[model samples]
Target: MDDVKPKVVVDPSAGFCTGVKRAIATTEKVLEGDGEVFCLGELVHNEAELERLNHLGMKILDKNHLSRTTIGSHVLVRAHGEPPETYKVLEDKSVKITDATCPVVLRLQQKVKKASEEMQASGGSVIIFGKASHAEVIGLLGNTKGKAYAINKKEQLDSIDFSKPIRVFSQTTSDQNEYEDICNQIRIKSSNLSNGNPDIEINNTICGQVSRRGPALEIFARSHDVVIFVSGSESSNGKYLAGLCKSANPLTYTVTGTGQINPEWVLNAKSVGVSGATSTPEWLMLKVAAEIEAMI
Candidate 1:
């Protein structure tokens, strides 16, 4: 029998982003301590990573679940960040807080808040390009006193009154191309309205980390016969990355862990590639690669 060897190509962008790295590092540090450590939310989007950390004694707590837990416990904030009110509620319960919000997101939140305040002062509306229900979107909206409007598609731009001045921004992990498309549509619509005002101000607030992943994943996907895209099912960016790969190569498969891999996907393929989202860990990808190698 001929020795079957599978070539594995890993995406350059397939590791933890700065925010997720920081959150994981903090969680590891807390786990080393003597106290009972609790995470305000999932430390990262990857289920495998969460499960590994949970094994180390890190407790994941949700809003309702947190309500049932004892007060004055140590709570670590995840990368997605929380609204100021969440902190206040925690404080009321005397919970000690350790924040691990992604620095990029932290900066974006500050910029959104500051820009919103400036817009409110100048009688302009704050418009965000993002999923309305996302926790990050909620945090951004909270900065605007609930006055901010979210636009997920080009059609949402029509709801805006062009007569009024507008300031636009997006969630850090949003699709960059979509963000630009919406901005262009808004500008074109505002131009035709003849509201007797200046040009609509559009701010490209999408993070460079998220924006750079598209091309990277595209290039990596093209070099392999079969591509495996790993990410937590809950991660929007992970799904987007997988979609990019699928568009580039029809043989792309999305999985949350190594156990999801089917040997049949690589039966006739020699060069198999693996990639993951910013929230995914490098160790997980290596494990998946090892699993594929064993199958060969």
Candidate 2:
């Protein structure tokens, strides 16, 4: 039994991405001095990280909170940027805004805004390859003044008049492979609609960090006998990356934290690799590794 105990290895590359790191650091800096800072939404998708931040006196709020914000209160616009109207409400209520939007997301918002303006003038359409309900997608559409179409599923393509000109952009954290597939489908349909001369512009708007992380995680997944994927359950990309790990190593299992790990999953495994989503905190991953060590 001692010889068979699995050696737990936490992936060094698995942890918060640069943008999430920046957001967490910014929030921590504010919380340390300000006490009870208001965040517009969950700072990051990882629930464990959110819990840690919440314990540190971060108050998470929704859009409705914007309307009722007390005058001169400090409000944090999370990494998932908000609509212009959100800023307007905060300003009207005299809330001090600390913008912590990711730089990649901010640039995508600007590009989508400009594209929508151009499309509006020429009777074209701006299409977003992302979840319609995602906070970032909502912000992207707001930049277009509610003029852009968000296509999360291929079936939603029916809503678009592809016969007209089109521009495509993706949420910064969207699955890169999925984005490409959606773009290809859109392009093919547009060509069929417009007699092979589809007028379309697709922007490489997905975060380079997300785009590069997939391949790296795939390699990491393949290198391990068993993979424990840690991430907030609500994270969209977490599911995708975890799926990548599952694909590479069928013994992969996902958990929000150490307590969720199943001892049965690591049975007969000689080497267990632990990895996490971009929003996952490094300390959480380390704790998970320790838990795995205890289990084995």
Candidate 3:
């Protein structure tokens, strides 16, 4: 039995990406000071990290709560960049805004805002290929002044008026291939409507960090007999990475933490690989690997 114990390996590529690392580091640094630190949203999608931050006296606030924010209170924006309007409102209130927006997201927002401004003059519209209510998408929509159309599924393309000039931008963390497909569909539809050339501008705004994960995780998953994927339920990256792992290895199982790990899943596995989303903490993944070792 000792000789037959499954060999477990944690994926080297798994854990928080550069943006998440920056956000977490900024939060820790802010918490070190003797002041009220309010994060605009969950700094990271991982519940354990949130718990740790909460224990450190970091307060998480939503949009509604943010509206009621008192003047002079310190607010930390997460990696998902907010709209210019949010900054304007916060500035108007004299709130100390510590922006921790990811550079990639910041660039995307700038591009979207600029494109939307250009299109606004021409009676064109901005369309976002992403989850409608996602935090990042919400921020992206803010650049369009509430006029951007968010299409999460291919079927939603029908809602777009192809006759008008269109500019498409994707959420920084959205699936790259899916975004390209959506843009292609829009281009085809617009072309048919115009009988030749379509006035469509496509912006590939997906973060390179997110764009590379699908293929990297696929290889990691295929290298093992069974893959243990860790991520929070509400994390978009978590769901996307887990799906990639599942597609690569049928024996893949997703768990938010160690407690969710099923012994049965590890029983007969010869080799086990552990991986997580961009928002997942390395410490959490280490703990998960230790739990799997204990089970074996």
Q: Which candidate should be chosen as best, given TM-score against the real structure?
A: 2
Question: Residues 1-296, candidate 3, lDDT per residue (tens digit)?
Answer: 36867789989988889999999888888888844588988888889889988999889988776678887888999998787788888898898889999988888888888888988898888998888788898898898888889998889888777888889888877766677788888878887863754678887777778778888899999999899999988888788779878989999999988899889998888999999999999899899999999988
TM-score ranking from best candidate downward: 2, 3, 1
The numbered model that scores best in lDDT is 2
The residue ranges of model 1 lying beyond 4 angstroms of the native Cα positions read 1-4, 195-199
lDDT for every model?
0.82, 0.88, 0.86
Q: Which stretches of candidate 2 lie above 4 Å from their native place?
A: 1-5
TM-score of 1: 0.93
Q: Residue 95's C-alpha lDDT in candidate 2?
A: 82
Residue 286 of model 3: what lDDT?
92
lDDT score, candidate 1? 0.82
**Tens digit of per-residue lDDT, candidate 2, span 103-205:** 8889889999999999999899999988889999999999999999999888899888888889999898888788999998998888786376457999888
Indicate whether candidate 1 or candidate 3 has the larger TM-score. 3
